[model samples]
Target chain A: MPPTPRRGASAVLLPRLGSLVVLIAGWQAAAWFAGSRLLPGPAAVAAGIGEALVHGEMAMHLSATLARVAAAFALAMAFGTSLGYAMGRSDRFDRVADPWLVLLLNLPALVVIVLAYVWFGLTEAAAVGAVALNKIPNTVVVVREGARALDPGLDEVARAYRFGTWKRLRHVVLPQLGPYLAAAARSGLSLVWKIVLVVELLGRSNGVGFEIGTYFQLFDVRMILAYALAFVVIMLLVETLVLQPVERRAGRWRQRHA
Target chain B: MLELDIRRKEYRGVSSPLLAVRDLKLCLEAGRFGAVLGESGCGKSTALRILAGLDPDYEGEVRRPGEGRLGIVFQEPRLLPWRTVEQNVRLALPQPLEGRDLAPLFASLGLAEHRDRHPGELSLGLARRAALARAFAVEPDLLLLDEPFVSLDPATAGRLRGELADLVARSRATTLMVTHDEEEALALADTVFVLSPRPARLLGEVTLDRPRGARDAGWVAERRREIERLRAG
Candidate 1:
């Protein structure tokens, strides 16, 4: 039998809350020893968060960062899944594209951002494009593994049944690739989140990264912590509420049997 | 009707190319069921793959009814784990089928209650039944089975074999099954083709003149001995 909804929710929620309390207590202790100027207590950072929300442009900057992440995430996933599927399906393509994938995978995200800014001249397209570029190879590598792992037995089944392109793709290919897509989406999102901020810090004038950059210049540890906490909270929510749920649903069939 | 004449097939090994099948010929009259009985690793599957048009690298000629659909039950169930039993069967249909239309087929397979269940939730026996249901739903003119009842318990495999024979007779599809089980070959197939080991060659063919339902355990025992004798010779 399945766990009751309320019990299941608490089973997950209580441990998370416990961890948060422990983390805050440690931070508060550190702050009491180091003093507020060096490292602010949790309450000082909370005040900084409230001040940013009310008097500063926290909402605008946060939205800007999110938009970049969304655009880059979508772009990387779309292109990465297609390329990965192609490479996985064809040996010739995989051999041909392998070196390029290696090169891109090893290239640092910072270098890619700097190159994009230099090449595209500090435009929004360049910033988002660079973030996407940094992420695509990782997505491709992961999704290609998924495509490669597809059962040849299922392929024969599809052919024996004479399934047309669309039917075979929907019922056979896509379902097999679902887990890979989820894996790419999860890792791709996290990668994009980190790189988008770097792109903003280096080239773009408006975003959470730029705000963080400004706070870093003034050495306002509280505000930096505030912005960092807010973004971490958003990412945590996305992981728990969005990515985890999707991963669970994609593999729900396995769970029922297990 | 279905016909296969494979002159040669070779696989490239690390050291040298290996021959898999040579001069293998088989023909099944329309609506007739045939079985190819061979030892394991004797390229029975290679020949089946050639017939199924999955191994085009081989030198062969396969003839079937023009525009006729084909259905195959592989060694494994091979059902999409994410799809329900009904949905997997529906996906095999050339045209859409209503739930009510599929209910009887499900009931016939003793899968009426499992229509909404995913393949992962099924026992090995039930999953094989689902695979059989999917094959029949396509209304195929040519049916291929590759050790379809393999790896199941003896009792489960026996029952499924009986059900499969009945279904194939009802559908009247020209079926070619590859198996090592003498009992299965004798029980279901109208003609059984015995094959030699490696670079597979046809040893001999046995035709069961008796109707499938009328074949008794004694007849099967006699036939198994005859097949063994032929294989040895």
Candidate 2:
């Protein structure tokens, strides 16, 4: 059954606390039964996380990974949105580039990462390039479809009235394309982070992914589990703090009008 | 002035052209309001589209005396959902229409309170009013409307038609509209052309020489008789 309506702050916190307790209990019981080699208990992983945080290993790696993801995400958004608009508006662009775009969309992230490393070298550029490449094609496909679906008669009206290019784009085109762009950004962010983590693990000597690899090599199960959990926590933070807020703001306009 | 002769259009894979307004000739003088009245699928919309320069696929001899700009309103409001009502009107303006100037336009249509609101927030009638404002704001040489009031209730449609007639009279824009309603065609147009269905052809023209305000029951009865004759043929 769905929980009853929570009327107070404490009522809201109750479920979260209950879920946490259940998770810790289950992990502790499993660790005691299996021993530490295969599955580190909650206490062991917490200790590893604490040790890494105090020594600055966790902070350094976390910041490096976050910075890379952030840069790649920004580049992806810039390229994808512009390219999507062009592809949507021009039949010539669609004819020439659509097949290539579809191929890129279907290409595996690993293959793109490998190709980028080979072409650009195993540097910061390569990692970011890999993530950006993986992200851009999907964004282009989604946003281009959005652009193509705009009403032709409305566009004709704009043209007949001699609306300047900027005015036409801003007032007529951008608003219609907002939701599609938002959806693409949301999905692109998730995919880029995951792909960036994998790319870091495969080659980079830094980042959360590299730290997890290091822990694996040393057979430190608790440290590996700690890094994985930390990454999950970061993903949740981004979803709640960044993406969800934008989604809600964009949707607010739609709701108010609808 | 605008003219079209022998316009023909067809989509692929059919036995014949979907629209063949053959030997169709129109000589619309500047600043006159004309209406095309016909049943559904009678190619009235196709003619309007050709005038608006949207359907370039048609073969036709077209002539316009000057750089005549046209603002076309389709059946739907077609306002960008993301834009506020003010922004939608602004789309029709060549430059940013000043807020003070826009206020009276909005007030005239009973939409002053909704200027900042998005199109999706508006009722169907209000949305149509915004669309009309968008068209009027353009200050076009010619305005083409394809059944712009088809979806509205009779009272609202009547009110909008009256408002539009006044706007056209005031602006002096050459207007060509397509509608199936005999009352609407007769009420708003200076000249209404009745058309036959399928291979659509012009039946005859009813010249409403009386000014818009003079339209009453007798005027409507005369138009009904004229439409009945066309339908019977």
Candidate 3:
């Protein structure tokens, strides 16, 4: 237990940073053996990233992808949470919506994207809609579980205190479901961002996915790696900056079991 | 004033429809404190729920002056575990504090220090105190408490009972409490309504003639015996 990790700046970062450095070194060595064309090294990819930012369409493509992710993530979470809460609280609603939920959850993402394009004629709405449609069912399932586990006694107290629908939702229901909503958001962000790529590749243009698709046809490995790496780094920043903070805030009331 | 006339209340059970309350009638005039004393599972809580408007399927009528305003303490401290103690109490008020200072209420209940703590961080006794604070925050015209003191150690229960008695006397809300503890009923209530076993009806009643201040231990013991005799008769 010499390296017993305590909560501090160094303790958390040291191990993760160590492993990541090792991974990059390993990849660099592999690239040297394979030659730069087949599997480019870290330096080549880094140079390619610098090149894209300086003289390429990286900004426009990155913004397009980011906007789609933000729009679709917000849309899915709002609609799914309401639907899930309704299903969880009402047996009749569950019965009516269960089959539909099952169908949507099992539907493949590629199929949804293709169907949306066919129906909407390859518009921006079609791309975001397809991505959100793929995501809504997952959010519904998680939030439904959260709603079902809610305490009946608390509901009684809310009713007795004469809390209006909106008040009860904010003070009573939302706090109870905060963790669930966070769970949905975390998963939805990952899913929506990845699917947005496939969506852009399939029908839409002017996104990271479209650029990657163009490079794939031209057989440009370095540019492809650069775009993919940049997107992954952006997502990592979001996970740290946005989602993690929200999850922590939502669980602030949890008591440590002695 | 508050009135309840629960002719019948039934629950859909496995074997058959289980009757929980029948022919149970209670009336507490404005500014009076009343207790319903009954055996365990004698449907006392069902009667209280009907009165609090928490249960709607009961076959009866409940008449109170204000329909929307209510203050209740359930058998368990049904606090929103995520909220701080003060937030739980404040949420029960007709408005957010209603422009009245709650510092006195918080101080008198010995919860001034613990007001910002969540219910999850509290012991049962402290949670019960928070529950009592919530019930009294509204200065409710009718206060319904369903065994608010159950499951606490005797010392904490007694302390809470004392604080409750003081608050009830000062607030003068028409209070109705349900409990199986006979002495507790005798100690605090102006009228203790004794109830029979299942599908409960009124077996008898013991009414105290003195104000709460004069009702010492000796007097409470005497009334307890009187209630026993009345129940036997």
Candidate 4:
């Protein structure tokens, strides 16, 4: 017989917790040998986290970082999906845009960020726009493949039924593209998070990246670890709570069919 | 009613333009059932696509009803795997069939219990029935079936063919089915147009004068021999 749902849940959860415990134990062992200032134990970092939370500094910096991530992710996904879909559908558009896409994809993220800062000044628009620009090419590539992989057999079904533009998009095109969209979202989120940190570290005044930079200057290792750990935890939560659920839902049809 | 006079259709092969269909002409009066019988890859499907207004690049004058709707059953089911069977059928309806009792249609197709199931959950026979259901749900003026029962087992194919004949009779839509199966063409169609291999042109057309219900296995066997004799000549 197959495992019951409750038993299955425990089977998945226990190993994850076991890995976390093992990682913390190793970190603590290393910290003890290195001593406190050079490398704090997990307990010292936990204390630093508690201090920052109590002072409300962690909340401000975390929220600021999250806001940047959200803005950049939305911008990249919207523009990239449209551009990619257009390029995929039309041969003329694809030919014209192909070289530019290749160039954008190969362009260094750091270079784009620096150029944005220099051209637009050290503003929020520059920071978010630069991060979005860096991430757009990846989203475009993923979504373009999705659009290209659309089944022509299904396209005939649409044409036979005389499906209008909206209906075709909803029933035929989008459902086929669901997996690719989910892929774009998942990769795009991870890419945007990393770039947003770089953007903040380079120019921003008040985010986890800026806080980490400040801690680095003072050589406050515990506070730096604390902020890093907190941000990691928050991102993990978003992945599990928001992104995974959406992906699972989008792909539920496949699971059921399989 | 439908009329097709396809002059030519060519595919860009590695070295030359491979012609698939040439000078293929046929006409079907309204409420008549017809089948284009040909070998696989003989452009039968390409001909159907032209009639259905899907392939406009061909040189042809296809005179179908100006404002009529089309319901096509592809060689494969071509169902949206993500949509439930009923959802797939509902999507093909020309207008919102609000408060409509689709249970009867599903029951007739032997799909009543599987309406909520996705297409992948069903067997090949059941999936074809779902495709048939989707086509009939629209009450289409022209119904196109491209080898609807080609890949099924013998018994399943026989049963589904019977169900299809019954549905087509009731709907009375001007139907055009393409099949390589001579038996299937003779069994279901009022008129059968035999087609040649590549650059498919009409070989001949046979109009079965006898009603479908009166034609049994013995009659079909006799007709098959007659068609073979005709082909030889």
Best by TM-score: 3
lDDT of 2: 0.81
Which pairs, if any, clash in model 1? none
lDDT of 2 by residue, B1-233 (tens): 86766456555445753544654667678888888888888777877777777668777777653557666687888887777889878756654344437776788888999999888778899999998888887677788888989979989988888788778888867888889988888888888878878566777777788888888898789878977887777
Candidate 3 — which residues are off by over 4 angstroms?
A1-6, A255-258, B66-68, B216-218
Which of 2 and 4 is the better model by lDDT?
4
All candidates: CA RMSD (Å): 2.3, 4.0, 2.7, 2.1
Per residue, candidate 2 scores C-alpha lDDT tens digits across A1-258 of 243454998887899999999988998999999985869889888888888899858988988888998999999988998999899999999889999998998999999999989988999999998899899998898989999998786687676667788888877787678789889878887788888888899889999889888888898888888887877788779988988898777666666633
Instruction: Give the CA lDDT, 0 to 100, for residue A95 in model 2.
Output: 89
Of 1 and 4, which scores higher on lDDT? 4
* Model 3 C-alpha lDDT per residue in residues A47-114, reported as the tens digit of each score: 99999999988988998999999999989998999999999999999999999999999999999999
Residue by residue across B1-233, what tens digits does model 3's lDDT show? 67888899999999899999999887777888899999989999999888888889988899974543677898899888888998888877776556567789989999999998889878999998899899888878788999999999999999899999999989857888999998798889989998988998887777888987788889888888888886787
**Higher-ranked by TM-score: 1 or 3:** 3
Q: Rank the candidates by TM-score, best first.
A: 3, 4, 1, 2
CAPRI quality of model 3: medium
* Residue range A1-258, candidate 4, lDDT tens digits: 232344577898999999999999999999888775979999999999998999758899999999999999999999999998998888899999999999999999999999999999999999999999998999889989988999998988988887788989999999888888888988888889888988899999999889989999999999999988998898889999998998888677776654
TM-score of chain B of 3: 0.94
Q: Is candidate 1 or candidate 4 better by TM-score?
A: 4
Worst 10 residues of 3 chain A by lDDT: A1-10
Every model's TM-score on chain B: 0.94, 0.91, 0.94, 0.94
lDDT of 4 at B53: 89
| Model 4 interface CAPRI class | medium
